[model samples]
Target: MKRFHVHVVVPRLDESVRFYSSMFGAEPSVLKDDYAKWMLEDPRMNFAISARGGEVGVNHLGFQVDSDEELTALREQVVAGSVVVQDQPGAQCCYANSNKYWAQDPAGVPWETYHTLGGIPMFGADSRESAAPDAGGACCAPVTSIPAVIEKKVGCC
Candidate 1:
């Protein structure tokens, strides 16, 4: 099975959590000082929000798969389309450990495809040491001036 993933960067975490909790009709399954996540079954979605400093809007979109096989299958499809994919195996972000692939769309929207392996204590580790030059502080998407293209760098969620 796969769950659709949506991560948004908000200006205020508490206020956003209240709004989303009411809208979703459930509290977050995972809540932190700066992040919250709802593993919603009705829509089969992994909805997350963070206040870690970025453009205050939709941060990235992705899919969460159940198994490595599914992730590989998705990756194959994305690669076939000639999309530049960056693979991060055992990435720690969003209070979870995951194996993920990051890419960008035609309109410069970031996309992530990942399979969660387990949980982590913190939001994420600093990725500057391993990230590409263009990869910004955010963990999910690579910061790029050019639309529809990006390099691999891990930072935030």
Candidate 2:
């Protein structure tokens, strides 16, 4: 795979960007009004930050797979290793389209394993009526509001 991935939600975009840029010693590879990403070679990590108004802490952790096969392997391994809370084949998130599998660690931290297919112009797309609800919720909606809705609809949260 390409690298390990980490996504965090912060309270302020500009402040967080400056903080991470100084910490990483490089400007963001992708920057937007509320999101920024660093493709750091030193540690081989894809670190992303967003001021999308969440709980203001570590949001999710992940691995960036090299290909669909690699993603599939990881998903399979995860399903075998832990209970997969959600799986989305064409998830639109963080301005990209990805195939993702979500699972929660024992500590209740969500882990995302995905292979990014390509970029999109938006942070998130509205789900089709028949589509399964995204575990992360739509657009910049509060993550806290999602679990109850998801659990109600799918019996998993």
Per-residue lDDT tens digits of candidate 2, residues 81-143? 756456667776677878866666666666677788888876666353124333433342223
lDDT of 1 by residue, 1-157 (tens): 9899988878899999999999999999999998899999999999999887656778778899999999999999999998877777887778888888887788767788999999888777536423632333565444443243433322344
Best of the candidates, TM-score: 1
Whole-structure CA lDDT of model 2: 0.67
Which parts of model 1 have CA positions greater than 4 angstroms off? 129-136, 140-157
What's the C-alpha lDDT at position 120 in model 1?
A: 82
Which regions of candidate 2 deviate over 4 angstroms? Answer: 128-157
Q: Report per-prediction Cα RMSD to one decimal.
A: 3.9, 5.6
